[model samples]
Target: MTAITQLSPRLLWQFFDTLCSIPHPSGHEAAVRQWITDWAQERGLVTIQDTIGNLIIRKAPTPGMEQRTGVILQAHMDMVPQANADVDHDFTKDPIQPYIEDGWVRARGTTLGADNGIGLAACLAVLADDKVQHGPLEVLLTVDEESGMTGAFGLAPGMLQGKILLNTDSEQDGDVYMGCAGGVDANITLPYQAESVPSDHQALRLNISGLRGGHSGININEGRASANKLLAELLNEINKLQAGIRLSEVSGGTLRNAIAREASALLTLPKSANPALAELITARQQQYQQEFNGVDDFIDLELVSADLPQRVMTSDLQQKLTQALLACPHGMMAASRDIADVVESSSNLGVINTETEHIYVQCLIRSLNDTGRDRVANATAAVFNLAGADCEFDGAYPGWQPDPQSAIMQLVLNTHKELFDLVPNVKVIHAGLECGLFKAIYPEWDMVSFGPTIQGAHSPDERVHIEAVSRFWQLLVRVLRQIPEDKAASFK
Candidate 1:
């Protein structure tokens, strides 16, 4: 093991550092799966690998605690792979270079994967520690949770034997997540024919970069800028110049859960208006800098001359595409009246691309309530249809409804107070979690989620709080030790 793997928390950091060294991007997690299986076998823990590659490791209770109830500890093994555009790191084979920065462990120029990696590390640490007291334990490590919930959805009906489950995927340390928002992906496509460019026109590429983007779910309501929206805004200004510009191509965003930070467009304009267009772009760039001065200080817009044989999109198609994008909603649609600070409904225009056959756009819609989710999705589809585009929605996952009377909630509250002087805050999150899928599979199971402090998840700014990991470890151990035998029997 390397020095980084041999750091404090011994087994925990070792597993984490090893995980960071391996490349486990969403659909490609074969290497990580084999490593986990080897680790479990070496530890003598009873393990089973599902067809979808989800691993379930079981450890029988200590001699005297054999009669205690079985508890399921759950976390996803995959992460949202993201990095700065200028960084040359590849998620398929590069190791994340994590280091301490301002009290947080962050990667050099890529996402730290602390969102679920820390949760998985905590479970490994607990299983390796023989000194920690606990009942029969089952650790569930899921795959491809960042891109989709495919592993969770493929879990068999009777795969797990535990009646109580503890999810370790929450981002905040003290927040107990009992419920989460349900989400659906709406994919829209608009076909348009391309035409040859006129020899008299000049080609220019317009670029938008350096915006501070974050997780679409967590930052949707924050009013942070989106590159797709910024591009549309710039086009709207360019149209004012009336330079006979013809849009050739447009593309932006990579993941559904990440906010778009950069976008580029190729266009052709009459040579007579070259000087006037350049002046307009410069002035608009400065205007935007002053407009979002404090919030997005690094935001920039650039235009450069380029040459192309053929025009990507015809003038008619470009007009329709730009109008549709600008008409589409791209931010919080509604706020939770029930919860003062929670966002109830929101939509994110995650991805956009222009191709020879069609123009495609992907949007993610989220809502705390089922009816509200449908409403938002319907509204979104209406926008696309109005713009003469065919839209389809898929990958809809249910939300975990908050249960105030849950037995797990009581245990967590009591255990937290006993471990520390203060009680932990219990609430629901606007983001989606695997707990929602698990609840649909086993409605009788009681579930609660909590984790260490992780910042800038789903973005290159991702980080993990160094101190919170130890505290989180301590809290998990305390909770396991306090599960009374009588209470455990009641569930069975």
Candidate 2:
């Protein structure tokens, strides 16, 4: 057993350690799902799999606690698969090699999957141990939460019997989340005309790297630079110089929910323009460094020689696409008036790629209300549409509105204060959570999201605090036992 399995909360850490051995990246969850089902069955818990592949496990109430309101512990089953550009690890076949660093547990060269893995571990720990007090309980493990909230969106009505849900997905250890932002995916496709590269032109690749690309929703307000936008800006500057550069290919970012950290472009230009292009790259890199000073510590730009490509995008197409990319808005757009110091609306220019017939772009827009989200979505679409690209919005989900008079929220607040001698922060997150979707399906269900302190989520730098997990478990255990009985109906 690893040292992590020997943490204070042994069962939770052990389960998390085992999870690190499995490959459960978004949309490829069968192996991990089957493992969880088999493990639950071995423990004799009642397990059910919904049509959308969401898993539900049930445990009867503790003897005298049967009269309390039924509670559901919720978390997602998938993790975002991200790695540093130089990391050679394959997420599908290799285990995430986790090790202790200072006081946190982190993977060697890839994402640690602790965002929901720790939450899932907590649920399993509760199920396997009978010592914890609770009323009727259900554990809901949803799928594909990182790429898309497919499991939550397709959740059928009346599948769960819980009136209260405790979401274990929030990242901050001492904060209790009451609401979250809604989101939509804006997909843009631009068809381009291609022509044979001139025989006299030489090929060069412009590479952008070393930016701290983080969660598009959580870190969008931090003023981090987007590699896609940076590349487009550089290309636009090149066009102004009348350098006769022809774009052959461009690609950036990995997931739609992560800010573009790295991007590269291939181009063909006359050998005579090489020296000027090199000088321009160095000057642009220095400008970016000064502009993004403390936010993105390392901003690198390089021009390297490459083999000439057979075809290049028509000059008109190249100019139009780069201009559209530059015009698309990114980062925080507005601050919330209702909640102090919180972002109300934002968008991320998450991804861009060149394909054989066309180039594709993806942007994620987030807002606490439908109007703000649609406004940003419309503006983004308008930019690309004017450039002759087709735009479509998909997988839109509603935001969770806060309830001022929630009984469970008060109960959680009181329980935490009593147990820890410190009141937890009751706040709303700008990031999208499945709880918002759950609110639509089960409007009467009172929900709260809480978890341990996780830093650098949705990136290779992801890690979880060791001390925070113990405290998180303590709070969850106490809250489960203090749940009040239902006054309107008799407990089943």
Candidate 3:
């Protein structure tokens, strides 16, 4: 039996175990979505599916709580799909084998999916609970939240009957979230022609890996290195030689929301320059290790001989692409003035791919301030434009403005104080959340976010604290019972 099956609130852990059996990675949530619907129907709960596959399971309040206001419990149904290079797990077929360790729950060589899975499972547990004294309840399980907010973006108007939204997607147990940053996706494509490699040159593949990549927006302030940027930096250093070389392929980073942990490039180098190139790569890796100091210092670089390629990028195209990537911005650009040590604006060079005719790069830009996001996006586009690449900024989402005076916020704060004997910190997150988009559809809804303690999200190191999960459940139960009678009646 899994260790989680022995945890408290047996129903919650049971549902979480069910989640582990299904592979619901971002954009491929059909199987999980159908399972959730069938499970809800089996229990006689009213289930509704939105156009984009978002599920809403409505549960009538416990008899005495009917007069209270309706509340919405929201969470994403998707998880980031990532695994160690050496792990042979297929996200579409392999189940996440999570285990207990040192009071934490982690998966073997892959993400544990605790980022939002715990939240979603909590909703299911609540529905199954006969003891929960909650009002008319709606569990909003959305899809594609890891890669984008498509489900939230397509939420139907007037579909939700609740006015108080409890977003359970937050990652900290003792802290509550009142607001979150907005984000945009930028894609740049540069056309290039490939030429046949010189007969005398040798093909070499350069790789950089072993980075501790976390959520781009959440960890952008951490001075962590980006594999994409590191690869480009190496290429730029080599470009200075002005020697004849041809790039066959260059790529790294998987998702736009994830900080790139690995990158590699296939190129043709002069047979005589292999010795110097190897030495330069070694030195560069050392410099990067020192640059990061102790954090993420396990940076690794590998240079290996490869088979000859038929085509390589033309010299002019290679030069321009290298210059553009070097000039591109990656990581935090501004700090929050209102919140100390909090990031206000940042960008992640999350993906890079070299194709037959073009090199494509993807960036996710996040900002609490819309103007700041626009400024950074414009700067990013300018860099590619000057380098003759076609760039576009799309999929923009707005930020959630904090409302400290809201009734739900006060209720949450008071509930935490009662449970923990201390006031919980209320903060705005730099990461993208679906709250802002939900507000667009239902402006009348008041929202607050909180969840169990999850660390190293969006990476294979992701884990959830076991103790925190119990506390989070207790807090949620208390919050459901304590929504003031006057406030509940006011929503109508």
Candidate 4:
């Protein structure tokens, strides 16, 4: 048993510790799935697994509680895999080293997986707890929520038995999420030819690191710098300045859902212009630092020597690629006109790859409405298309629409008020969630998402507050016990 399991909130943390000991990054959920399956079997509960690894663990209502409405406790089983560049632990082979620090539970150097892990553990605890009361219970544990909503996408008709879903994948403690943004991924490829390096040219590598990379959806409004965008700006400025620089290689960002934290590039320029190029990059770095002030206080830009290549990108291709990337939007394309301070439409230049054949750029566009998402996607495609690149969009998912009068929503609100003695903040999110995909199939399902307070999700600094976990557990317990009776008959 890990030290975390022995903490104050022992039951939930115990399951969380077991989860951290297994390998379950995105699509790799086999081990954890087997363990949980055996756990349910050992308890003599009925368990069903779908074709795509979505698990349903069902327990009959506790004595005299069967008439209460059936509740589906939902959470994803997979986690986003991320680590500090310096961390040596392999996510696939090693258990996350979680420890308590200043009242928070954090992993040593990798993502703590608390975003949905805590919620999953909470479900496990509730299943094991005889003291907590509930109606006919169904736990719908989906898979691959981070890489894509694959499990939710594959959820077949007639598989789920509940009309009410309580998604525990949300991050905020007091906030109840009713709706979320729909999103799609756009790929832009620009074919290019290499040209011989000019005489008297020096090759230099420019690297930008130390950005507080975060979830593309949750952190879109934070104004944190996108490394891909910043590097593109630098390259575009160098081209405009006519510093005799030629692009050799460019790369940044890893996943389409993560905001880029670091970017680096190779360029060849006239030997004498090296000093001027460095000075310009330094000035731009200072400008960015000032612009980001408190958010990205330690943004670092470095210029160093790199091995010379026989050929570099042709000047025309270099300019075209740089300009297109610069023209492409990176953040806050639009805000909600309906809800105050809630983001409606947004985009993330999530990844860029400069290879021998072409430079590939992938972007994720999100919005509360399909029309808004299409509008921004079309505009982005236009930018790359006008620059002579082929643009395509796919992997689209629907958004959850808010129903303020939903029974599940009102029940959660009342339960939260009773537990915390304060009005719960209910709002919509600008990110994608499995709830959206699941809602499309089960249109009659009433859904609400809430969880413990998790900070820095999808990044190495991820952590869950100790106190908030207990409170969140309390709210879920109370809400499950208070489910109305009429909905129970409807869950055939």
Q: Estimate each model's TM-score.
A: 0.95, 0.98, 0.98, 0.96
Reference-based lDDT, residue 357, model 2: 88
Q: Please report, in order, the local distance difference test score of every candidate based on alpha carbons.
A: 0.83, 0.92, 0.89, 0.89
Cα lDDT tens digits for candidate 2, 179-275: 9999999999999689999888999999999988888888888888999989989989888878788899999999999998899999899988888
**Candidate 4 lDDT, 15-34, residue by residue in tens:** 99999999788888888999
Per-residue accuracy of model 1 over 439-488 as CA lDDT, tens digit each: 98988788999988987888898888877876787788887876656543
Candidate 4 has its poorest 10 consecutive residues by lDDT at: 483-492
Model 4 misplacement above 4 A: 488-492
Which residue pairs does candidate 1 place in steric collision?
none
Decide which is better by TM-score, 3 or 4.
3
Output the lDDT of residue 186, model 3.
Answer: 97
By lDDT, the best candidate is 2
lDDT of 3 by residue, 119-168 (tens): 99999999989798898899999999988888999899988898899999
C-alpha positional error of residue 31 in candidate 1 after TM-score superposition, expressed in Å: 1.1
Model 1 ranges off by over 4 Å: 1-8, 486-492
Cα deviation of 479, candidate 4, in Å: 1.0
Query: Which pairs clash inside model 3?
Result: none
Worst 10 residues of 2 by lDDT: 483-492
